[model samples]
Target: MHNNEQLPNQPTGCGQFDPRFLAQIRRNLFSEIGANNAQGLSKNLRQQLEGLPRNVRKEVVEEIGDQCAALFYACESGNVETVDYLVKVCGASIEQRGISMCSMVHEEDWYFCTPLGGACAAERLPVVKYLLELGAAVNGSSECGSTPLHIACGVSRIDIVEYLVEHGANVRQRNHSGETCLMFAVLSESLCGYLISQGVDVKARDLYGRTALHYAIEGGNSQTVQLLLEHGADPFAETRYGNDPLQTACLTGALSIAHYFIIRYNYTAERLADTLELLGTTMIDTSNTQAVMYWRLANQLRWAVPRYIQKRPEILPRSAFENRVEFSTGADLDAIAVDEDAIRYQGLIILERILGIGHEHTIQVMTDVGYQYEHSVQRDSRKCMDMWLLALQMRVQKHSILHYKTCTTARSIVRLMENVLHRNVTQNDPNTLRFEDVFAMFQLLVSNILETRHLLSVQPISRVQQDNHDNTVRCLTHLIYLLLSTAGNQTERRLVESSVRDLLRHDIRCVRTNESLLHLSVSRLKMLESEYVVDKSGTVGIFPNVNVTNLLLECGADVDAFDRTKSTPLHTACLPLNHDREVVRALVEHGAHLDRPNLYGDSPASLLAGNLANDVVLGKHISLKCICANTVVGSGIPYQGIVHRMLEGFIRAHEPV
Candidate 1:
């Protein structure tokens, strides 16, 4: 091990500290504090440590700072009594710092801090004063460089903020992110006013180059924005992303703040129109149906503005959708307000145009819009598929073929295709799911699988990479099932066959289950069953599709390959839940040996016999080669020495259960 490399399970230079004991102490502290028995708590804790050797006890006491310390817990719980006991008797350092383990309102909300910072975070002003009196550093920072004043202001603890500042906490201190107390205090109007009065810079930019006004706008607090602006916060101050207060308000869907900016800041009529359009588009990305509200507001504001300032263009630029909708001046903006479909697509188009087609945000909004279309009252599969196709094209270009985003989008499309095909078949509609789209999606999946295998050949793969490869494989299988379901014409059938052949030519196996595509198609694995039931489309038990089974075999899939359970495709097909006779017949026709046993010593023929209660005979006319192999195995011959090296394993596979 290199000197610089640390074991993940062990902290630096503290091998003697046992994390289990620390966890036990946490549990005991909570229970004991709840019982209000501070004396018993201290006594029991000391006894737990007394069992260890003196050196280990000292190490545990000192190393508590490296973990969640008792002092921080006491501070957070406002248990001043425990704070004194731990520091005075238990040898805990007064300045001990660690992750605060109290007041866990959220799982990920805990933070690393000293005792004073912990108290301030929990808003326990009494505990803050007690820690300060105990000589806790008033200006002590947490692991993130956040001082007590920073925490106090962030959570709007104005009283605590005043006390900390009076106790000599630096009001101008910047954290590791270059954020001052003023930046964190922007959410509180009184706190912001006080911090400004104390000489904190109101216009100070953080490491992200965002001013206090920008933070206030993003926080969606008008009063805080008002206070910061009155204190000289620049409304035109831009962040590193070039987003000012108005743009921040638009992005965050803060319509009231945007309105307030126009009322107080006197934004131009053109600027208000642009902001309203941006706001409407943002709402479309988030709220599918409520996006028209902003369009109506924009029209109302347009009419409210003075007639002289209404020098708008005859027609705004068309949105980037296929429909290319354009809004004319004045009353024409109301058209989009009434058309929900236009509102949905126009929002997606505006986002893609602003964020770039290949940006992750664009991809996400596109996928979200597609989901809304799919689940709408009419189940608009056409619009849904269109959005997903656009998203898939961008994802394939922007991300790796096996990236989770690309794989996820492709899987969603395949599942949608399944639902569409089932609906079409039930409704007797021949033109519901287009054959060209299925073929195109199938070709994309095959290309991704082949590319993933190529990458695997050139580089060692990680677990994440292997899982992604398996996911892509599953996507390909579901897609092929769709193709097989709708192979109505000779051209479509040929496309499906060619794609399956291209996919099966690679030596791909599901990395998690170690099952080949043939095994997966035949067995209907447990994970795949629940995954197939995406919605209440009522297309259950569609897997083990006989056409998909035969297609894989026709594409030259290995029929006798062993999965992780040492079961061949035949053994899997013979399982009770997956006893599809057609699948079994297909496998047998593909030269799957019926008498081959799995690792559990159960042959396909025997398992099938057990399942059928001798109702039908299978593999009755055994070949002479199989008879010889069975005779050697049944007679307990040492075939490993007598038979050819390749034939030895094959002969052993036929041994009796």
Candidate 2:
């Protein structure tokens, strides 16, 4: 046992004061506080010699800081009355954090200060509500970027989630990992649905580039995948490493999900090849004693073989190598035969390749084998199994192994990429090929993308090389342009919208990169729209494709960006007869400056505030767009339902009804 003096940052050498005596004093103080013995505590505090030494008393007072120790205990115990008295009578600050003298990391959010956060951690929702009403920051984030709402949602405290949301906790707020409350809610489909309905980006990627769909797929929750898809989650959304939902579903053996994508989309063969490539090898090791132990289990036994062979060196003698030898029924020889029977198995290669299970899972199988061998090796009762060594008397056939030709399919995909992606795609009219078909071709090409990208480092881009780059970019840019143009055609729009986003995924998901295609698309859009500055494309064109706009914001776009005319995207959306609620909501959710003035000293908010139709058109029972547009964050008035009612009245008076 060590003294408190040995502990890092623990104080020591207080005259004759002992550590054991100090521990007893701490225990007594907490016990009294826990029992709410205020009179006993006051008496103990007055009796300095009996309670604590004069020097220790100064140390205790200095360590905890001015008399707010009671507040931490009260908050931990959910003692609201004591908290009220401490804050009001003693002038204790609710925001006051107890600074630790120790060198360890502090619980910046969960404790120290923040009575509201403390009460929430204890599931004291009523106390949480009370503290919030008394002016606790609803959006106060903890050390790990977890807000009260983040904690509540994580613990499935829906009541707390509701309260925080209603009090204006930002639902779009990300944690330290760039995960949203909605990402946490994926484990609960109902919560996920509600968050999606609130306009949280279904397209949002976490730090790992996994969308909500990726999480749902990885979790094997098919129903949750359906829910995210319904909310416009892109099926082809890729991680930074390029594993999309299909690759993830196949890897996890989510057959229902893999089948769902296969039925809807094409190129299942190419996708499987990519999965096999990711696994590093196409075949598992096969041996004769397969029924007893698989390749994975046998691989672990290989290490023990040398030790076992050393014990029975006669099995590897030079005399046996020189002359034809016959083994006698010796105990060592029998033990070797038994050991061999216990661990030798063949590969189940082709099926494993198609199923997508690999070394990662077999590593766990090793643990399972060890546990079973330890617990059941001594069992006398025989199992329904045949040992190849014992049953056949060592006469089992030693067959040659074969492997699946995954690379054959991979080569075919490469040829297909060279065929499709080598030509100028935009040279032909976008209407010549359906955007959906073009995007499917793009998915296949990129899915089977050759290591030829590595060649760029080896040599300069030639005319042929530049053609390859131009063709892919042309395919992507044209797909985006066509998708934008075909917004009036409902079925085509639905079919190609996701593909357009898929093409833009690289630009959208990256925080910093060359958006050559995206920048070109935006410039082309402005060039295409010479007469009209705004279109009523709610989720798409009003302010650039909503997907492109969102990707820009995620990649750090300036919200108050002005064109040569000093008009922001907000100004474009608010132009007469061109207003879109979804576009405005999207902009505001990403922290777009509401009051950033363009040229001529006019803010976008002022433009909307002047327009009665903007409010009326955005009119609904607590319309989010109205809240988003009107909720000037620093104005002190967050979104309120009453604000909607007031606007609805203004709309009714202006309308014929």
Candidate 3:
């Protein structure tokens, strides 16, 4: 009773068994018997006969060998010879597992509890081949409906894949996970290359709709990318996440992959143009100083690239218009068929170039367009003009205002004033002057006119009756005095003096009552006398008739009035070391306070004594202390507070000590 021996009463001929098949089955059964009992089968003849058919049953009964069962056991034990013998000699069903109880089990279902499944899990090529020889269906399902090929692929067994696929394994078959063998190959680069060479579908996608190409891009594998692309994988194919391969490459900073997609792949012309434009604009937006540099480089490459400029000849070549220029000269001008739309588009491109360079070229081009086709360029021409004007205005105003506020020293102011005067002279023509220069000049001219008018209206006895008349008078007088002292030429001086004298005799009594008029009158009279020593009686006598010094005395003009520098009238009048003496005498007799001490501790008497004779009695009754108190109080709170505190401290210190 060998384990592999056939049973005599086994139902073999019951289901269409041919003699050749039965003989082969019997031979396999005998082979299994020999291997199961290595010592040899039992010698008793009745042992083999007990299960044999009876004389009547012998005609119908055919014995089936135990080869399949023996081979299953051999595979479980990893016995190579026994499994091979059973497969070749027995003619046992290759798809059958070992005999189970009373029936033969299908090899496909045997994976439920068999060591054969374990062999497949270990990725043993021998075990896979042995099972296939014993009629193991290559595409047969396991317990969970996964074929052996599926299990092999999941384990990334390249050998198993080769063996199974060679032996008619279904490559497209999926497991319960809905993943094919190709997906498994994609998980391993070696496996992927092997499968691709073996004709595995590289374009196959998984349950997530991601193809092998998608995975390669996501992983940023340059080798895999090149392989897939070489095999006709679409570079422009978007993933399930809606990102194209190029975008993925850029985002991952995969330079190699990006270069392949951009340079090797035949991307659409429009898409290439748009992508480059976006890159350029984004780089510019992110930087400040080097924005133009980046933009120009980007655009240069974009234009030079044949894909972007093949059809746009207007933008591509400078000689395109030269041809048209010659053609237009002929009598029959070929219908003058200019592509205005194309020209406009080219204009936009030129504009972008101009903005990037930020040079005079852009302005020149725009100006040329305006001049060449002024009537036809109504809308664009106006826009160009506005842009030029705005740019110029910004440049000039920024320089002028910044200099005036930050650098107000005498030397700097003088230089700035000289520059302004020079520009005014040089750029007198409105056509030649930039908008910024014109704007600055307009402000200056308006300011001068308003000041001149105000001075004429606020002069004493002038007819200027209006609601803000006092403020008007004060502002006008101050402006006139500044102009008189700082006027750049004789024209400015004459204009200031004329306006001052007109206001001095203005019919309006309120204007006549303004205290600033008397000060302006004396200043103007002195300027007239200095400018014209012999003919000074004309304008200078106007002040003498009004008697500014007397008028100021009546109007409570502090003779020792000092500005922030604390210079008294006498100290200021005696500046340059040689002013007219009659003007000084008039100021003195009209109650000019002579004993007033300025911030520098110099009295009007001391100021005059330095240069003028100290014994010159200009006034009879001069309250020196009153004059000093008036000037001190009018000098603002800091100076006034200092004087009061000093007096208080003196009285307290003397009383205590």
Candidate 4:
């Protein structure tokens, strides 16, 4: 290294200390301190401090003043004679506050001033002894409420910690967060050993109700955790979240610490079994089946299947049964190949096994492929009825399929639907008449079949009596709506009208009641109108039969049902955005809440805002009721009157906006 004397000076133009001069002082200071001078010569050399700027000089003086004030710091740090000179000649004083140098001394300074914290950190003995003998405060706290003992314990400085404890440093001094020295020790192995030697309280808890053992387990320091347990840290201590250390360790995948707790705390096999069972149950209850599988896999890999069997033999049998199927070596067909009705059932079984095997990417590919196939089938005139039936069957089967419980499975199914819908809308063809018929059929299936099934399944059976006759009537009503919506030939129209009249006279009294199902029905009805409602006047009747809307309302459907935009049925119908106005009028008559805003902040009135003629025609008799009364109105006013004009002028003048 170059000597400080050879270094270049700071430019005069800088108007700061010569960088070279400062560098030389720094070099000499470090060298002098490292030399641990034993004579008065070092003190006489202090005159060199005058060469620095006044501000720099003050800083150096304050720094040296601390050194001079804590003479024992020098002595404890093995600078005996230099400390003597500083104390005797420099007027260094020893105050009752221990080193008493300055409040500026940091936590790291405690380690440097004396060997107590350092020796504890490094497991040194003689250095610690000299410091203790020279009146070093073994229990002195730094800015963070950390004592030398805390430092020693935190870093596993067993020997220094023991030395400090023996010299009367309080073993129980808590830090800013009420974590005691023993708790700090549990953060590291060496400190744990030192605290154990000193008989420190190991069972102490922090402000968060976390005991030393909890920290050890949470920190995944297995050796420290074992030491804590050996010293009687409570294994059963629970955090504010009601989770014991073991559960926390398990959740965080700290297997070593978890095992230590289990072994040392005498955690029973039955208790472990119960924990696993509860974990699985909670996963299902919280819709976290993915986590359930992860935990199960962890238990298998870490402890081995034998241990799992010993805990819960039932899982082993289930696992064995599920994995019994043999997959083909190199199957390379697209996912849609499995969409055939005969193959779908087998494919579902195979897919469930694939999921169990954890081939997640493969499952995703299969779901995507299956969705594409379903879309193609819907768009093929010859395959429309088959596709609809297959979709209905697949949806029903999903409810019974255990595989669908996982979030991944649910997400895959949703992606499948989205892909199918996109493909169907893009592939419209005049030759595909049956394909055109599929949209109306889908509406019937979703509204009449799916909704009724879900209602019966979810409703409180004990609270209501079932009527088989009413079910038929409802089914017939759905068939009539489908027929009218798909009215192509006069024959089909007459058949549908006759069916509607017959269902209207039926004594059965069941009506559609589920919102999602109702939305599905309306969406399907709208799709039908889009495909087949062109009229002689060059106008499109993209409206569902008015009777269908009336029937839905009678069955307790909200006439003003909103889309994700909070756009009511009337809003959807009235918007010139390619929808049916007649449908909008029908919904308005049936008591649809017109004021509900969509996600876009547009209400029925706002949706018609751009169409002055339509707005004038509809706005006169419309209600201004809001879904959420406290809702703020948008910027546009209903009307601009004289009062509004005066307010606008006053506001503009005051705020200049």
lDDT of 3 by residue, 1-657 (tens): 443434334346655434453354345444544455543233442233233334322321223234234444445445555455445433333444333211111112223323244445555567667777666667866444566666565566778777888988877776543556665454456766777787767666655455667666656678777788778776776655445677556434454676677887677654554344333333322342232333344445556656534322233332212212111111212222244423332343433332321223233333333333322433232232333333333323332221221111111212222222333333443222233332333333233334444444443432323323433333343333334334557775555445445444442222333334444444433222111012222232233223434444444555644444454455555443334466567667766656555566665666666664444463454555554444444553234244578764422221211
Report the lDDT tens digits of candidate 2 across residue range 459-532.
Answer: 43333343343344433444444444434467766555555444444432111222344333333233221111
Q: Rank the candidates by TM-score, best first.
A: 1, 2, 4, 3
What TM-score number comes out for model 3?
A: 0.25
Error of 4 at 410 (Å): 32
TM-score of each: 0.61, 0.35, 0.25, 0.34
Candidate 1 stretches with Cα past 4 Å from truth are 1-249, 256-273, 284-322, 401-405, 425-431, 453-468, 525-534, 613-616, 619-623, 626-642, 652-657
TM-score of 2: 0.35
Better of 2 and 3 by TM-score: 2
Listed per candidate, the RMSD to the true structure in angstroms reads 10.4, 26.4, 40.7, 21.9
List clashing residue pairs in candidate 2. Answer: 287-346, 289-344, 290-345, 290-346
Clashing residue pairs found in predicted model 4: 120-157, 156-191, 565-598, 565-599, 566-598
* Distance from true location, Cα of 279 in model 1, Å: 0.6
Q: Which model scores highest in lDDT?
A: 1
Rank the models by lDDT, top first.
1, 2, 4, 3
User: What lDDT tens digits, residue by residue, belong to model 4 across residues 1-657?
Assistant: 212233355455444767456555545544564455555225324555444455664443224433332343444445555544443444443322223222111122332233244334444456457556667678766544667777666655565666677789888788766777766655567766766676667877766677877777656778877777767777788775455877767544565666666665676655564444333322322344433443344344434435433322222222212223222221322232332432332333333332221333223323433443434545332232333233333443443211222222322222222223333343354322332343343343333432344455553441221332123333334344444444667776555545444333332233333222233333323221112112122112323446666555555555555344455566555566534455555566776655555566566666666764463355544544332121222433333353467544432221111
Compare the candidates by TM-score and give the number of the best one: 1
